[model samples]
Target: MSGQQPGRAGNPQVFQPLAADDPTTVAGYRLAAKLGAGGMGKVYLSYTPGGRPVAIKVIRPEFGEDPEFRRRFAQEVQSAQRVQGLFTAPVIDADTDGAQPWLATAYVPGPSLADAVVAHGALPVEAVLLLIAGMAEALHVIHGAGIVHRDLKPSNVLLAADGPRVIDFGIAYAADATSLTGSGVTIGTPSFMAPEQAAGRKVTPATDIFALGQVAAYAATGTPAFGEGTSHGVLYRIVHEQPDLSGVPERLTELVTRCLAKDPEARPTIAEVIRLCQTANAETVLRRPEDWLPSSVAADITVRAAAPAPVQTPPPPAAAPAVAYSPTAPVAPATPPPGFGPPQQQPVQPPVQRPGTPVPPAQQPPRPYPAPPAHAHAYAPTPFPAHQHQQQHPQPYPGAPVPPKSGGKRGVFIALAAAVIFTVAGSATAYVLQKDDGQQKQGSGGSAQGAEQGKGNDTTAAGGAAAGSAKPNAKADPKPADFKAINLTAGYHLTLGDDDVRPQQGEDGGYELSYDTGGYLDAETSEGNLVLLDPGQEGSLAVCRAETRFAKNIYLTKLAKGRQICVSTGTGHMGLVTVQGFSPEGSPSEYMTLDVTVWRNAVGTGSGSRS
Candidate 1:
């Protein structure tokens, strides 16, 4: 977080200022404002003359002129540019060769995974699964490009509104980049680094996989595999000791252990990691888990600078058949290709010069049409048959398809349909091939085979603490004859019972519910029930009972012992379930921790269904 401060000396709001007033600007862009800064450098708010905001980071003076650092920086940028991913921050522009080297990309606003954890706590199992799968998918892409994100940890991950996004590629490299450190200098986090990394061995995709494992463990248990220790002690443990996974859920321990393995070759490949994560029943990780989403998939993220807040006009629904990029426009279109969306909304425009003003011809506008947004352009037409199009049209890529007047409409229809079909098929094929390639390199089946070869561990929580009692708030009325039947009206509806009551409300403004097993609800006494509640909030909430088969399969008595049963949403909100014990005579006793959960929600969705 320590870096050069740009503006005033003592104000928190006076961050580095960017050059936004002039078109031909500073930092290789029309600087707008300071975005954020870190230990290495300051990221500025800049834009193409066309008005696309790019997060531009200029190297500190200390490192910019260092020949070694510059060479490495150049190589790193090249490697980063080759990575294609939905969950990773992609390079939009950079100039490592400049006087003051800098790297720039699309600015994403969100809390880091580290911030999320520190602010909230451990995420629920489903959120952890999604995090793992998304990071794995990103790694698969980086690996495919012959690069590895050597520094893969929670601090470098952004939990954006859309999903998880891996950022900060300063330490990423090609598969064979020269080592950046001395023999004894460590390059990664001690708690999450692979054994090989700790041993100072060459890093690889497996190393990242191992780091991801530690990230997952931390996500589930609010702690890392190696726990707290001195750097040397942590390294030693990573190299020679076993991870203390007593607190980790049964379903996640195997994966985390494999990731912490001393032999890097033994770890699962990125694809294999995704497969296990996808196959694993995340429900067993937390009770009453939230729904999951693929955070790794690239989203059409549009971040605009707030000024008078210029309005963007979307492109026409259909464009006349033409080349994707026109000679007049070399900039990539903001919108994806046809079938993705209506024509893209172009980047914001600068003030127009008056008719009598002598504006430089170089600064002349390309096309009057505004471009579409990012997702709209992600699937943009790959350049068409360039030579053929040029030779046929001599004018614009569109008007060149000269029509025999009457047959014009039919010709355009056939061409447009072909373009849509081709784009769709190509995208699908690429996704499948990429997925397969990732699995092959990581040897995922080996771990699954190991899992199958090993005997399954008992996952039942010890002590029958299935019956729970209502703890009336200190402000509430005296204990009701039967809290369950008393309509304990406070501010919200409270549903409580062993019977499968349709999703109801709670005492708070949010939906509230509490249930117990009793003879009155013998029919509802099957293992567990799926309580799906749509609070008419942002999204619905779901709660699964402990008696359910999936819940029993992943919960461990050891993990639940003396601990409260809690589940979290992907958005990082957690709720605790009380654990009540029972005697042989059917008398319910005070609650003592022994409850288990299979699934929970992740962090950062809208408001909760239940408070």
Candidate 2:
């Protein structure tokens, strides 16, 4: 909100200092202050190594592990790099493989066309003509690269001192890939949608042109070509009705009309639109010496440009942690609230400590796993209660089956039968023998009696039998990772797919694994990265790669069978984890029983597609 006057400095409401939690530097560039924040990540004003200002966007941490999101993000970023147009914000640098990926673009210091429309009702006929030509030129470059902007609207167009700059083209699908969207489903902003896009039909370069028509009409009429309403109603109008371009200027109406045609074939190409604009206003130039923006908007931009950049100092160099990880570190259950600790099929059973093994720290950073229902091992006709004070457990995991009691009863019967046979044989000997033989028979009979009597108080043998019967409980020893299968919910999944993370047993009967993101992930950023923690350094994503490569890759050491992988997400929480058996009828995530011990203040963000 700063403004400057002749012979005076600008006011001080232009920019503010960084927040307490904001990172000082990102991907080697020192940050000054925030530009904006969105669901994806925060945008900050940073400078390249050479000191020219840039707008850097840091993706939210949870997106790092989403396979689908990562695929889309990588494809879009690569496409963005190929675009070099006069009316577009050019991408300068990016780290698509980092834990929390980020990209930097040449900063365009201006308000969006949406803001301009809100402030000043409708632009003059000359301004509307200029807007069309500039956007067409931008689309020409974008379509030339075999990419579709998908969502093109007034909010995505910025009006700078020079001209309008089209921004945010990173959501389009890969030009060469097939669609992952469900049949008859559409993807885009509603009000500005093209008819074909709204109907879930195939889109082409002309799809953007249709949106271009709406943008131009809005700039001229100060409202949408399609009447405003709910998303469904708006979409219905786009597909079934003609555009109401009643308020667009007469001189530009014909061109806008052609762009808004229901059929893609009826739309004019970007090149043709530019030629018509040139014919309408031969003097139009992107770099017009005269101020082109509305008076109030131009004054605001002038004041903002005159303000000084926020002061920033370089962060201190940081030393790296240990170069190696201890595979022998004690294993534990993977906790779900903040981690996938150990599986909780039954009540949490304490792990018996073994001597001489170095135990990992008791606490670790939290993961995005959810805790299994309290009656995790039990099966019933009704759904398990999650918020109740007590839980009923009637069964254990099949992996730890309870042995039959009939076997113990059979052993006792066999022992008693042997004692009776010995007594009968001694009595027969007594009848057949004389005095000396009778004495031997008596001794034998006494021994038989002693053996039968011993059964009454055979506490030692009974104790052994009781221990044998408890073998079912003994099956509970394997840690979370020791389970055979794991599934995830729709909202939660690892970048490494099910096949990639399944521990493979080699010919040598040991887990054989390569430390990589199977076929889908980037080795540069994931080599040692743990999903439950922040990328150690923004300057370099490889800081924690060494520690997490094996974990991320699902390499199980003999020691890892019960290994406790402690995770630390930048969010304040610790995750204790163990994995076990899965339910038969639910999703992988739902049945993937994890023993999770969330620390005192675990966050609740992992249950959905985090941001």
Expressed as tens digits, the lDDT of each residue in 1-611 for candidate 1 is 01112222112332245455322344546555674554456666555555544566676565665677778777778878887688887887777777776777765544456655665677877777778877777777777766667777777776554467777654533212333233343335567777877776887778888888888988888787788779889888888888888888888777787777778788887767766776675432322111242222111111111311112444679865684544333332232211122322221221233434553433332222223335433444343443233234332333454434423434344333433343333323232222222322243333232223223422111000100011111111111111111221112222232123232333222232222221111112122222211111111123321111222111222222122333332222223332223222222431222222222221211122211
Residue 211's lDDT within candidate 1 is: 87
Runs in model 2 lying further than 4 Å from the true structure? 1-17, 172-187, 282-289, 306-311, 314-611
Question: What TM-score does each of the candidates earn?
Answer: 0.43, 0.46
Give candidate 2's error at residue 272 in angstroms.
Answer: 1.2
Over the stretch 366-390, how does candidate 2's per-residue lDDT look in tens digits? 1111233556422211211221111
Q: Model 1: number of clashes?
A: 43
Candidate no. 1 TM-score: 0.43
True-structure RMSD for candidate 1: 27.4
User: Looking at model 2, which ten-residue stretch has the lowest summed lDDT?
Assistant: 1-10
